[model samples]
Target: MNMPNYFELFDLPVQLPVDVSLLTANYQQLQRQYHPDNFATANDNDKMVMVQKSAMINDGYHTLKNPIKAAEHLLSLKGFDAATEQNIIHDADFLMEQFVLREKLEDIESQDDFVILDDFHSEVFARQHDVYKQLLEFINKQDWEAALNQIFKIRYLTRLIEQIEKLQEKQYAL
Candidate 1:
């Protein structure tokens, strides 16, 4: 198989904030084009080529569809090792803030305090605004490195929201 271009791999613009509908459409198109059945009458080599392309297409679909995943992929693409840096998490104040908020969340569980969830959501949303402002700066300066750094923090906040949702589900299921 040819080295896959991002456009051909995701079948979308090599652009940020990809259009969801178009991404899905392109994915379906590739599935039809590269289905193994299309190569059924071809030689074994051709069939293997089709199999490989299909796998790449599927992987690309996943990476481009989610913002957090896309940011991680983008950082890797730019040769930035976010995981290698301890500096991002080296903010002692921020670490203490997270610990305090987590304790508050745990305490509110017994109170069935929906207000605590709202407060957490509001706090994250507020942080998102700051992150977005930084994102704008990165975009203005064309600094993929800064954008990549802030994006990782955004992903961390997103994961917290997902955890809250899961906790809500488990609580309600009881």
Candidate 2:
């Protein structure tokens, strides 16, 4: 499929911090217009076209919907090689920290043992906040390279939080 311009894809401003109301309206309109059932009059090829367009619209909406995702998309468009999920561990220290957190989470022996997990959560949240700040600041300054690195950091922290939440939920289930 030919890649539509990001702005054209979502009917958005093609700029950072897009007008969200306009984007939302346009997305819904596109979705309704291209919904496969609505293309019943068209031939198979035409229907496929509509389906692809609808998928592009959905993809574009998601990219511009959240600030972190928007920032990452913008950076990627700028040619920054923001690490994908597979390459999230660019920093050894960050990986080691995740390792320790995972270990602590598995060894939760008692209610009191959960205190250390709480402390770890605080530390992780703080680190995640720091990464978020850096990402936003980089975007504000149009520093796509720095923003790419920050995006990876954000993904790492986000995954860690998911793992932590899983562990916490398990503890409560006991």
Candidate 3:
């Protein structure tokens, strides 16, 4: 059976930046329409179908809500399965920057200053934002290769931010 993509299921455009309010409204509407309780009085086959549709609605909502997942889904719609693609970025400058960031993160953990961690978090967030913009631009131009690279950078920056937050939490628990 042919199935609609997440964007189609949500009645949304296939883009990275999705409208959260609309997505939430549509998700609630679909949940009400397809919730398993609504099919309790139906036939066995009908109940099963409703359960499946409800699951699809939930999965579509989550995949479209997350920027990274949404970007990956967009690439998949373009015949590029990013999950399985081995698109390794070999840019030296990018690699060096990541390495330096990691070193700074390690050093921040040993220090007792919250300001350092805050600054690091802001830097990583800014870098992630920049990469996200580039990803959007590349997706708009159909430059899948570049978009994939930017996705990797965004993922790395996200990880760095998470790590910084963890360190900050650890320090706070002192």
Top candidate on lDDT is 3
> Residues 5-101, candidate 1, lDDT per residue (tens digit)?
5555665655556677888898998899999999999999989989988898888888778755555555555665555654365446756766776
The residue-level lDDT of candidate 1 at 65 comes to: 83
Worst 10 residues of 2 by lDDT: 80-89
Cα-lDDT of candidate 3: 0.87
Q: What C-alpha lDDT do the candidate models reach, one value each?
A: 0.69, 0.73, 0.87
When sorted by TM-score, best at the front, the candidate numbers are: 3, 1, 2
Query: Model 2 reaches what TM-score against the true structure?
Result: 0.74
| Clash pairs detected, candidate 3 | none
Per candidate, the number of residue pairs that clash is: 0, 0, 0
- Best candidate, TM-score: 3
lDDT ranking from best to worst? 3, 2, 1
User: Tens-digit lDDT track for model 2 on 51-141?
Assistant: 8878878888887887677776676666664545345446788678767766665665344456776777788889888888877777888
**For residues 1-174, what per-residue lDDT tens digits would candidate 3 score against the true structure?**
543598888888777688889999999988998899987899999988898899889998888888888899888888778888875777889889999999998888888789988998998898898989999999989998889888888877888888899888988898
